[model samples]
Target: MSAFDCIDTFITGGTAVIELNRPRQLNALNRKMVSEVVEAMESFDRNEEVQVIVLTGKGHSFSAGADIDEMAEDDPIRLELLNQFADWDRLSLIKKPIIGAVKGFVFGGGFELALCCDLLIAASGTEFSFPEVSLGVMPGAGGTQRLTKLAGRTKALQWLWTGERIPAEDALTHGVINQIVSPELLMEETLKFAAKIAKQPPLSLRLIKDSVNKAVDYPLYEGMQYERKNFYLLFASQDQKEGMNAFVEKRKPEYKGR
Candidate 1:
């Protein structure tokens, strides 16, 4: 991956890691940083060598939130014309699985970003909140919708209204986070988990990810139809044939992402 100003991206063990830089600022999501993340993720999604993507930051905190200074500096009209968040639409369209490795503060837009991941591995002592309401604005990036879906309407409103910090333990209990590890072991465990998923059949992984996500957006019957179609579609892939044949022959299967 090429060098990026706000983030560092690299691929290893079929897992692509996009590490947010700017530790001094707690890796705030400025327009540039958000854009770089989307671009790098798209590239990784298109690369057959990369099967999973992990998004993390290189500071004590994953992200404090969006760059408040940048937002205050920009003219509303200019910002409107620029449509910075258009990249977010593209980010959501990525087909491959995304894993968020979070630590410390995950607030406002940062919390929203973490929720966008298909899976989350958070560090113990992390604090998550939607502080935008306190600032006279609400979450503009699907935070309200996603949080309500994951943590239930009552809990989501309780936090959103108070702008209170949620401990990692509570986040885990509410199903917002998949696992919690010590800060010292955050990246290690995240990469290890990502590697496990990376080793799966790529076509199957992508299809299943898509099918599962459809459950959130589609009606029950529609989601089942989508899932059933993808389940059947796998039979046409060479990896499916190899996987079954290998099982019958008592051999390890080698998937080529076909």
Candidate 2:
């Protein structure tokens, strides 16, 4: 029996979909939900058949944020305990690519979760914010770090300090989201994009994700070295030979992900 409760997971076309299932609470992230998400991600990362993972929420909202009820009940001791087992940290280390399909309210922890993804596709009218300031707290789940890195200090500071909701267009302009589609076509568009990525060679895809992440976390010189090494490494993969041969033969490459 699976341990996931707040998440609905399934696989299709080499892509795993992990949908937040708590629509009534706007798919709020609580301890259980966060744990489930991490487990699901780890499982998919180990699954050779799954080349991509799509994360979204059921119903109207992607996620409103962390569950306030859960937060309110946590004392300093419990909060400290929770910090010791930071699930978000594990989430950030996932090897496979993750695409976030966001809509409705994406605030606080929800926004942080999206930032953990490799790409984000949002609904046209999706709202994003960091309302933690208003609650006498601040984002504690890599919100400040990731947002600042993605959207520069000025935009990230303004958004975090004000705790005001920004439209999807504004989010995209600030580089917070990759693309936006109409709500009616959100899932269809996201799935289509995921399928396209899933068709790529899995080893190359993983290396690409690793190289990009290294560019963010490592010094420029070290990052360039890492990227160069990966580029050379791909030449040793079977998919590389197949890809080049397919082009010469005027045929499609059938990648075995070896």
Candidate 3:
């Protein structure tokens, strides 16, 4: 167990599950929690044994955003909270995949946290909103840019303007969530998905993720160029030859991440 009370991290089957443990406070993004999470994530990234990561929250909510009650005139407190988003930005550059299993309220920073994942799996009743506008502030995290990129300009504006929560089903329809499982099946399904990803060639997975993300931000020709570059680069790896040989041998490929 970690010395920190705000976050708990455990490793199972090569997957590091990072749980936001501040349940009583709705897993609010506080200074300690943010720092602990960032530390844990960095540790996970450095651990070669950890193949994938799943981030979730304990209790009824995934996260209710920053701890408003902790608001103070101190610059350190504000700076610490801001640093959580910085950690999230670094997550996008991680080689291993990260999956977010969101349930209950994933509002403000919580929603932005989910957006950081390569894949997002939410519970059927998950609720998402950007309520910072109502608080007379904008989303300090990647919510503004990520939301608009994920849900498009019109819908993103609608969500921000209304400050209304969207249900899991609606979020799925709008392309915000990839899958919605029952509350009881949340972790089960998420682990299953993570395991599936873990079985793939690690370098290939990273390259594919990078290519797709680049495609999202680039033009068609530029995206294709990016894909072509990655394709040839991956083909040069030993894993690529192993994958091909395994196919011919009618056996599963054993990727050494070469």
Candidate 4:
């Protein structure tokens, strides 16, 4: 049984789906929701059956942002103790891939949550924003850092400062989202993509994610070194030999995730 009241989780075909369930509040992220997300992610990471995770909302809006009502009452100390944003860091540390399936409103903390995913697939009519500036607060999560890394400083600064809602097309153009599809096709397309990745060798997927993530934090040469190490290490795995031999035999490789 799930301890979460604000979210729903299930696994299908090696892909786990975590849906924000508070439709009444547009799934606004409160402390409880954040905590539940962290706990669910940790559980999924330990579950060998799950190869990928997809995050979405049950209703029209993916999320409206953080719970303003809760934020208004909480003091700095309380907020610090909650460690809401740190949950995102924990999610990122998971070896398996995470895909955000966004639709409708994705604002403020909601935007930060989507950014935490390895890839994002947005509905055509989805709206994304950083509305914290209007709330007289700034994004406490990795919003600033991750947005800047993805879309560059100028665009990130412009969006954060203005608190404007960016449409799916603009968000994709800005490199915030990987793909955009009709609302009805959002889940289908996202799951299809996740399934493709899930079919790959688990160890290779983990190494690929690790190496690419290093590019953001390490210098060019250091990133290359990390990539090189992972590349060499793959040679020792059974999947690598199977992959090569299958190519030679003109057959599909059966990866056991070794």
Candidate 5:
């Protein structure tokens, strides 16, 4: 019934969701699937109706990894020519927040996909790993860099070199994830958290996301300057005035996202 081969999308009020649909393969991410995901997120990034996005999988696993069958058949030269990682970079361009609601197996490329999100919440039993080391390769996407940024170099090397599984609790303690819940409550809690974020002024959310990303890539002084510039720019928005004036008037402010 869906137009897409690998994903199903739903827009619910201020939150949009993209659900991986390859349950039979444990939601394996093939080129088709990753392409579809980038396409959908780009559209949502441009859509004013969408305030945030929650990405999840339909079945027991978020994704086992990239499609091994597809990879096994690829010639090395052809793989380099295809350059699938270019699509993954587009995810960083999206200005809105993305919350990954992960459960079960989140392995290799799947683990990298979760790392791409602005925030992550996982079901209790979820396992995160990069088994690419055992496969005689390493993460081609931003896995090594991103994980090392958050979890630091020592832990990142330990996990990457050994191909060990990181459970939800361990991931939380190390800052790989924001929250953990029972499997049944994962989506429910994620949506609730997203809705709370959605109620804030749109421009603030956009700028905040941008500033935080700069923090990851920029030096401390430069990041602070970027943050200050965005802070000064927000005063030009209609929502900023409405928010401040409403507080003085002791009334709820209505935001037009201007």
Candidate 6:
């Protein structure tokens, strides 16, 4: 259990909880925090017992964004840290699903962090925005691309260009978030969702996620081809047969990751 000042990482049953511990700073992302986050993610990725990841921050706010005070000194180290933190390869490639439990302020890097997750469940009172434009910078993470893909190019550009805060309801309606629960219930709801996913066949989940993510980067015909191939491949697995048999028998399916 390696612990860092900025993050608290723990495994509970099938889920890995990554908590941002900088409440006084509203869980702002700094170089140390970014390094800790990557470390925690890597450890969770290697742990077979961990099937899902739930990322959230402490206190009323999720995260206010990057630490502006630290960014005051603009140097190569700062630029490199920014780039490393923004890179999707750090977390998005994990086979297990990652869920973001967002509440309060989710601005700039905080917003980008949620965008990195496979699913985002926000509190009804959560505030979301990409204020990098106002700061004379842009979303360094996959935000620009992910937001556009998730909410459409025009909408994404509108939000980014304006640097305005969006409420949870609008975020959900725009596909920026999956669900909106009460602030107090945000963690519980996210856990419920994670547990539900953890109960499914792990192999199927990983394959489906890969297929969709990869297909999205291709042309329509190519994308459908990948989907068809993935569908047929899964059908050939023992888990697929067991799933159907279990349904017929009215019993829970026991998946062996086959």
Report per-prediction Cα RMSD to one decimal.
1.3, 1.4, 2.4, 1.3, 1.1, 2.2
Question: Highest lDDT: which candidate?
Answer: 5
Candidate 4: where is the Cα deviation over 4 Å?
1-3
What lDDT, from 0 to 1, does candidate 6 have?
Answer: 0.86
lDDT at residue 239 of model 4 (Cα atoms):
97
lDDT of 3: 0.86
Worst 10 residues of 2 by lDDT: 78-87
TM-score: the better of candidates 5 and 6: 5
What tens-digit string does per-residue lDDT give for candidate 2 at 1-258? 345789999998899999999999999988789889999999999998899999999999999999888778678888797683478899988989899999999998999898889999999999999999999999988999999999999999999999999999999999999999999999899999999999999999999999999998899999999999999999999999999999999999999998
The deviation in Å at residue 224 for candidate 3 is 2.0
**Alpha-carbon runs more than 4 Å astray in model 6:** 75-87
Per-residue lDDT of model 5, residues 1-258, tens digit only:
357989999998899999999999999889999999999899889899999999999999999999888888778899899998899999989999999999999999899999989999999999999999998889988999999999999999999999999988999999999999989998899999999999999999999999999999999999999999999999999999999999999999999889
lDDT by residue for model 1 (1-258), tens: 567999999888899999989899998889898899999999999998899999999888889999998887677798789998798888888999999999989999889889889999999999999999888888887899999999999999999999999999999999999999988999999999999999899999999989988998999999999999999999999999999999999999999888
With a 3 Å backbone cut-off (N, CA, C), the pairs that clash in candidate 4 are none
- Which residue pairs collide, candidate 1? none
Q: Tens-digit lDDT track for model 4 on 167-215?
A: 9999999999999998999989999999999999988998999999999
For candidate 5, the per-residue lDDT at 228 reads 98
Specify the highest-TM-score model's number: 5
Worst 10 residues of 3 by lDDT: 69-78
Worst 10 residues of 5 by lDDT: 1-10
Write candidate 3's Cα lDDT for 121-211 as tens digits: 9998899999988987778768888888988999999999888998899899889889999899999999999988888888888899889
Clashes of 5: 0
Cα-lDDT of candidate 5:
0.93
Per-model lDDT: 0.92, 0.93, 0.86, 0.91, 0.93, 0.86
- Among residues 3 or more apart in sequence or in different chains, the pairs in candidate 5 whose N, CA or C atoms overlap within 3 Å are none
